[model samples]
Target: MQSQQLWTVRWLNAIGDVDREQWDKLALPLSTPLLEWQWLHDLEASGSISPRYGWQPYHLTLWDHEELIGAAPFYLKSHSGGEFVFDHWLAQLASEYGIDYYPKLVGMSPATPSVGYRFLMAEGVDKQVLFRNMLSAIDNSCQQQQLSGCHFNFIDELWFAQFPAHDFASWKHQSYLWKNQDFEVFEDYLQTFKSSQRRNIIRERRSMSKQGITIRPLNGQEIGTDMAALMYRYYLNTNERFGPWAARFLNGDFFTRLFQNYRHRLLIIAAYTDSAAPPIALSMLLVKDGHLIGRYWGAETQVKDLHFNMCFYAPIEWAINNNIKTFDPGAGSPHKIARGFRAVANTSLHRLYDPRLKILFEQIIDQANDMESANIKALNQQLPFAKNTRPV
Candidate 1:
């Protein structure tokens, strides 16, 4: 590891503290849209992830003399809400050991469960050296602040591989992902499924036509402020249906800002009663580099098969047409399985400052990981695809 004195580490309360160009230099190269400067800044500016909501931004950045070299988007979290990786059990374990779990350091794009997190580094720097120094900075900062040890969730596989050397324990989770297998068309995709599932999908799609509903995907130049506002209403309506269990993290302002500033990355699938009327259902997605992430969706009224149409079938068809390689329908819903989403492993890394809690984590983490792995395997086995057609 290089000497820590070679780099100066500073913590900022907001992403706006850094220049947009400088931040994007590192972020723009990433595959996921959530890590981009505009997304993180809007999350903070929109009050969706403020300190009052238990997410206090404490982003760590590194510099070498006058050059901005590396940074990790971090937070001082007071509770576990918004983070898809469930760690409430960890909090309970801390309580059992008479330790405090709140106010721990976390690193990820807020509220986003997709991976692709790592220290952003400039060219010509030894990545390992910079990573080691950054890890030191995180450790020192956590100790100085008397916070629980840090966690990096949904991290890129390359970065995840590096953490074990630094003693961060790995925790496994799962998410549904649809991977394109050189499919030339939507029908080609259906062919991979069993004959029964293929017929079922056809029936579900036929329902849209029977109900006189049309789904349209609008992107880039097609998105407008009015459409963005309508999408926000659908987003809210979806959450309201769930009542208190809704993870209504983003607000109307965030939606407005997203459409205004980042519409190029947005894809809205609008389901209308017909071409003459407004959309009754909408699903908002982010697309970049042949990957699509289904973020939010809602419907003003419950239409039979509307959720499946707007959320899965329509998006998958559009993704196939656009040559998208992957579609990550954001967390939850076993229904995605029958529709072709496969349960894939997702991981998070952790380190606890309390020795007793750390020991407890070590003792139980392997068993927990085993259970999750088995669950994923079992879920995949139940998928509607033919055994030979399943991903290896």
Candidate 2:
């Protein structure tokens, strides 16, 4: 491994400090769009992920002279609000031990529950070397600051294995992922389900049309500020409906900025009652390199089966036509299984600087992971696939 001293390590107060072109050079090649420079920058510039909201931007960068080599987008979180990985139990444990858990360093796309998170390393560089040095830098920062620990959530599966060697324990969580099985059309996808589920899905998709509703995917230049503003209204409405469980992290400004700057990666699955009328409901999604992530949804009023059709069926249909490889229907809801989303493992790696907290984490991490694995297995077992084609 190369010495950590070879690279000049810098911790950024905000992503905007880094050049957009340089940041995208490392982030663009990644499979996940959440880590893209524009996304992170907008999150900060819009105040959705600011100190007032408990997420303080503290990105890490590795530079070789004036050239950027590696970057890890991190946050100094005062509370675990937007992070989808529920660590409240771990926080309680820390409290029991008199450990200050808040203000800990965390790495992940703010408010995004999808996977594929790892160090954004420049091409042609020694990835393993960069990975090691970055890990070392995080460890040093945590220890020097006397913070509770550092965690990397919804980590890329390929990078999950590398952390254990560097003393980071892995915590397993389950997320729903729909893989394209060479589905040529929406019906081809429907055929994967058992006859009972196939009938149910068909009914659900039809329910929308019966109510004089039509769903269509609008991408790139097709999106406008009015639609973006309406989508934010729906986002707020959706979050309000969830009440206590709502993850209403993004504000209206964030959505407006997203449409303004990141429209190329945006895909809004909109429901319309008339061809000339405005959409009554909208489900916003992000796409990059054939990977789709269902982000948010809102409806002007309650409509039967409208949620499933617009968010799932319509998006799935569009994905098939576009040759998208995977569709991550955001976080939450085991009910997605009935719609053919299989339960897959999502991992978060942790390193507690305090010896007591670290020991407790190591002691229970295996048992916790075992239980989670069993739960995921049970969930997949309930998948309505005709031949049980769950991922191995």
lDDT for position 62 in model 2: 93
lDDT of 2 by residue, 152-177 (tens): 99999786565456667889998899
**Cα RMSD for candidates in order:** 1.8, 1.8
TM-score for candidate 1, please give it.
0.96
Q: Model 1: per-residue lDDT, tens digit, 223-252?
A: 876776888888888889889889888888
Please list all clashing residue pairs in model 2, or write none if there are none: none
CA-lDDT, candidates in order: 0.88, 0.89
* Ten contiguous residues minimizing lDDT sum, candidate 1: 1-10
- Separate clash counts for every candidate: 0, 0
Worst 10 residues of 2 by lDDT: 159-168
TM-score per prediction, in order, is 0.96, 0.96
